[model samples]
Target: MRARLKRLLPRTLFGRSVLIIVTPLIVLQAVALQIFYGTHWEVVSRRLAAAVAGDIAMIVEMLARHPGEETLAWVTREAFARLELVIRLEPGAVLPEEPDPRTGPAEAELAAALAERVRLPFRIAWPRTERAVEIAVQLPDGLLHVEAPAKRLFTGTVTVFVIWLIGSALILFAVAVLFMNNQVKPIRRLAAAAEAFGKGQDVAPIKPEGAEEVRLAAASFNRMRERIARFLAQRTEMLAGVSHDLRTPITRMRLGLAMLTPRLGEEDRAEAAALERDLAEMEAMIEAYLAFARGEGAEQAQPADLAELIEEVARKARRNGAVVTVEAEPSLVVPLRVDAMRRCLTNLVDNARRHAAHVWLGAARSVRPSGGAAVQITVDDDGPGIPPEQREHAFRPFVRLGATAGAGGTGLGLSIARDIVRAHGGEIALEESPRGGLRARISLPA
Candidate 1:
């Protein structure tokens, strides 16, 4: 039940906040309406009905005491002119056999009011006409018929009350929405900044604002970002220095080996050549380590054609005598660090070229489950693919598959590619391709 409720809830903080504020407001308004209609409105209707019934009793009493044609005419004329009531005298008239079932409060109130004030055999008719009520009180010689306007007994206080209640609720809701939006804006900015940082994009420092908790969160995020940046900077500098120091020794050894090669005997020259190969492999390893540790070098994100980038990588691989097939949409642009993304694709393509005779590179636009746009690039090869269990191990730096360990690589290609892809808020997955080899799938948000 808890999980189901969570699924039904609004996803964003802003939407949930508004729901929290408005839910109670709606419940309160409903309660207020119930009270007004059930109690206040009924009370007001009863009071008005009683007042009108009293007026009718007084008119009937005056007519009974006078009992003459001139007096009756004067009373009817005076009632019409002053009280806004129509009174008439009907001679030799009978009452109805049955009366309406007194259901509503207004009808009940009028019936009780008439019984208390008048002592005659009277029948009341509440018809659907201009006049609200018709009271026919029987007299000895005739009958007294009185018609009163609907407004007299039923004042529109309930309608006015409802309007005032709804209007005030609407005003309060508008104010709540405005306040909630202002409160949520700072939190949204904090989230955006954090996401960008996680994706290795350079974002400006967030200025703490809004509520105290939001301000505290922003401050904490800034501190964490600074610490991570400092750590990366220190690590990159250390690796760069190591690479620089090692390169000097390797270069000196290479030159010395070349100088001794021309003067040495066949056995000595063979030994020197093997030593040169070792030195060259060491140089390649150092270069790979430096490249992996550089962290793409503070390159800002810019819109670039992803399809073109893929095609270029494939073209380069093709030039190196690899059979490369490219299938990519034209002009699929996305915000990314061009150099970093290009390097990542080149690494994947290069790795494929090393083990496979036929390489397939594919790029296309895709949609994520969250209704956002994404770009997917796939590199597949028809070589002897790594075992499913070992595919994950291949992504670890310096950890190569046993089958491909002797294939002349420093084993940092997949690791470096994964690092760059992940830095751009993307993922790299290895799976069995349709081509009977491994597939490197890269998915990046646009």
Candidate 2:
């Protein structure tokens, strides 16, 4: 029951806020109306019915005392002129039958009053002329007919009360919606800023607005973003310094190895060459570390042709003697840091090309599970695929799978690719490719 109610409730803060405000108001109005109808309305209606009934009773008493044509004419004129009632007398006539049962409060009240005050058998015809009630009272001489306006027994207060209640509710609802919209706007801006920051986009601090608590949250988010930026900057600077310091000695050693190469014996030259290769590999590893630390590196996202970027990566792979095919539209664009995304795609393609003979790159528009537009890019290769269990392990830093461990490359390829994709508020997953090898799938918001 609780879960069902939760599902039925409004999902947004603004909608829920309106419900919280209006639900109680509707309930209050309902209760107030119930009270009015139960007590005040009924009392007023009974009093009005009793007054009309008393006038009829007085006329009947006068007719009983003075039974003459002249007196009957005077009574009829006075009733019409004073009470706005139409009266007539039927000589030697009897009532045909009783009217239908009274249903409404005013009809019931008027019937009860006539039974109490007039003490005569009567039939009341409601809405006799769309605005009157015809009452026929049985008499010894004839039937006394009285047609009174329906307004005499029914007060206009109920209509006025209902209109006032509905009008006030409508006005209050309009005000609540306007106020809630204003309060929610600042929160929406804060959320957008947070999402952009998480995606490593350059988002300015949001202005504090709306309620005090919301403003405080905006201020806190700004402070948190500043701290994170400072931390990343410090980490990047430290890694850069380490890369520079290590490269200086490595460069000097390479120069020294080149100088001694010609002077060495054949076997010694071969050993020196092996040493040079090892030195070069070390330098490559250091550069990879620096690249990983640099991350998005102060780059702001802008609308770039995603298809063109994929084609550029394919061209670079082809230049390196790898067979690459790109399947993408001509003008698919999305917001991304060009350099960072290029490096990410390059890493994925390079890893695939190193192990596979042919590489396939494709991009297309897609929809996320949360119903958002996204761009999907796939890097596929026709080589030995990683085990299902080990696919996730491949994304761990420096963790290489056994099948592709022989490929001469740092294990950070997949890790770096995953990092860059996630930094763009996208996702990267390893799946089976149609080409019978690994597929690196990246989904970014469009």
Candidate 3:
């Protein structure tokens, strides 16, 4: 039980706020109930019963005044109906204890009160009992006693307190609920904004509103995000510049190799050619680094024909002896940086061409789990396909398969393709193609 309560305790500020605001209110209400009953309940009930005691006192006095048993009986009966008093000790003494049916014994509180030198508890009974039997009390040596009946058990005091307790409890509970909701709102908003930010989507930072500490926390988080963004931007700029500069040296060296080939022997020329292959790989890596830094080819996003782009890449590859086909329909003029989209398509097409003689480019609309649809552009190839386990690894930089060190290009092709697609809020994945070769799929929102 303790462990369950501990688990229910708040692990967050929002939950703590709700607990803080409501817990004390409930406790205070409970305490107030105890005090209300202790302080005024009996006093009120006794006040309602006082009228009967007066009537009984009058009856005893009338008997002393005149020798008339009928008058005495009439006064006693009237007193019994109004005041639920059965046995009331006169001033200065206590009343006797009576049996309680619920406990199979006398109530200890009742016994204790009666035993007190100052308290006198009267037994209140029903009106019908008065008509059945005449009650007589035995007075003590130093105290007076009177007997009465039970018709007046329910007094106005009991009704008033009952109504008050119920109403107060209900009002307190409603106030607690409202307080809990108000306390939890700010934190709930922060959680939603943080989740959207984690997914790398645009989200407005939560406004720093509410309690003082909550506002400070939100302000800190917003500041931290800004710092990290600036750092990433600077880092990207550096990588792009360095990568872009290295390409010039690599280009000049490749041209130098052409000049050297004319003067060297066939064996030496072939060895130099090997070095050229390594240089090309370095060039590709540098290009990928730079492209990642530039972000979406540094092109402004605009509506474009994805099918036409795929067909254009395929046609270029076909001119270079690649068997690639396109199977796509005219659809959305989507928002995309043209240069980045072109680069992604070029990489996928080139990679496909290297693996197979035939590559099929197709488009389809797929439903998302979120009740939305995505525009899917697929590349299918017919060659030795990538293993299922390695499909996910294919998009990593410098990761190559079914091809070697000197395979004529940097492995950055697919990596750059993925980056570009992601920048447009899309995705790329490798899977088995019907043609048995590596299939690269790019999905975007339509």
Candidate 4:
């Protein structure tokens, strides 16, 4: 039951805060109404009813004491003029067998008061037509009929109380909504800043505002961002230095091997050629390492035509003697780091070209189940696909499959591509393609 109620609740801080504030307020109002009607209003009605009944009883007693027709007529005329009551002396009238079904607190109080003050039997009628109460009291001579305004007995304080209570509740709710919205706004800005940072987009520093907790959170986020930036900078600089130091020696070794090759015997020449191949491989590995370390170099995100980017990648692959085809929506623009995205796609296409004769590149817009829009880029190839178990292994840096290790390249391509994609708040997955080979799918928020 608790879980179901949680599911039914609003899924935002502002909405839930409003619910938290308004629910208790409504309950308190309802309890207040109950107390008013059950205790306070009932007491007030009874007191009012008793006061009206007392007036009626006094007039009846005055009529009884007068006894003469002329004196009774004078008493009736004064009562009507002063008390706003209509009194009549009926000689042969009879009371009804049953009273009205809508008997209430005022009627009960009036009946109790009349019973105490008057000696004779009486009947009361609440006639709807005139909105008044009619009382028939039996005197020794005849029946004394009385009509009093119903409003005299019941003053409708309940209606006024309800109106005030509802008006106050609505005002309280409006104030609560305004305050909650203001409180949640800072949290929303904090979340957006974090999201943009995660996507490798530069965001302005967020000013600490709102409550102390919210300000503290914003401060912490800013500190974490600075720390991460510093760490990435230090790491990139260190790796760049290592790569630069190693490259000079490697180049000298290549030059030395070229200079000495012509003077070597046949066996020595073969050995020198093997050394040259190793040096070349070493150079390639160092370049790949540096490329991965640099992380595409502080590229700013801008709106770029993704379809054109894919077409350009395909065209480059084709120029390199690979069969490449592209299917993309034209003029499909998305916010991306153009150089980083281009490098990432080039790596995937190159990896595909090395292993497969035919490569298929495609891009299209997609919508997530959670109602977010995204763009999906697919690179499919007709090569020997990695096994399901080894697919994840392919994404790790410097790790190559024994079967495909002789393809003449360092195994950092997929790793670098994945790093770049993930930096943009996107994901890459490997699956079996329709061409019976590997399929690399990248999904990025549009």
Model 3 per-residue lDDT tens digits across residues 1-446: 99998897987765676567667866876787678667676555454345444454455455547634575466556655665443323444444566422221112233233333223333322234353212233333223344433333234655676677678767866776677677567767777766545434455667898778778878887887688567767877787677658777888999999889889998999899898888876776676666655555335577887777777887888898988778987765666677778888888888777767788989877775555778888989887877888777877777776553345567778888888788777888888887777678788866
Task: Point out where model 3 deviates above 4 Å.
Answer: 1-221, 248-252, 255-259, 265-267, 297-300, 402-408
Ranking by lDDT: 2, 4, 1, 3
Q: Poorest 10 consecutive residues of model 2 by lDDT?
A: 96-105
Model 4, range 1-446, lDDT digits (tens) per residue?
Answer: 99998899999999999999999999999998998889988888878777777887888778767777897788788888888788898876766667544477678888887888775688888877778999888877788888888778877777789899999999999999999999999999999999888877777789999999999999999899999888988988798789879998999999999999999999999999999999999998998888887886478788999999999888888888999989888888998899999989999998888888899999999995567999999999999989999999999999888667988779999999999999888899999999889999999888
Model 2 regions more than 4 Å off: 50-76, 86-150
Task: Tell me, by lDDT, which candidate is best.
Answer: 2
Model 2 error, position 10 (Å): 1.6
Q: What is the number of backbone collisions in each predicted candidate, taken in the order shown?
A: 0, 0, 2, 0
Which regions of candidate 1 fall more than 4 Å away from where they truly are?
1-4, 49-79, 86-150
Which is the better candidate, 1 or 4, if ranked by TM-score? 1
Cα-based lDDT at residue 423, candidate 4: 84
lDDT for position 166 in model 4: 93
lDDT (10s digit) by residue, model 1, range 331-428: 98998899998889988888888898899999898997677899898999999988999899899999878768888888999999999999888899
Q: What TM-score, computed on C-alpha atoms, does each candidate reach?
A: 0.83, 0.83, 0.52, 0.77
Q: Determine which window of 10 residues in candidate 1 has minimal summed lDDT.
A: 99-108
User: For each candidate, what is the lDDT?
Assistant: 0.87, 0.91, 0.65, 0.88
Clashes of 4: 0
- For model 4 the TM-score comes to 0.77
Better of 1 and 3 by lDDT: 1
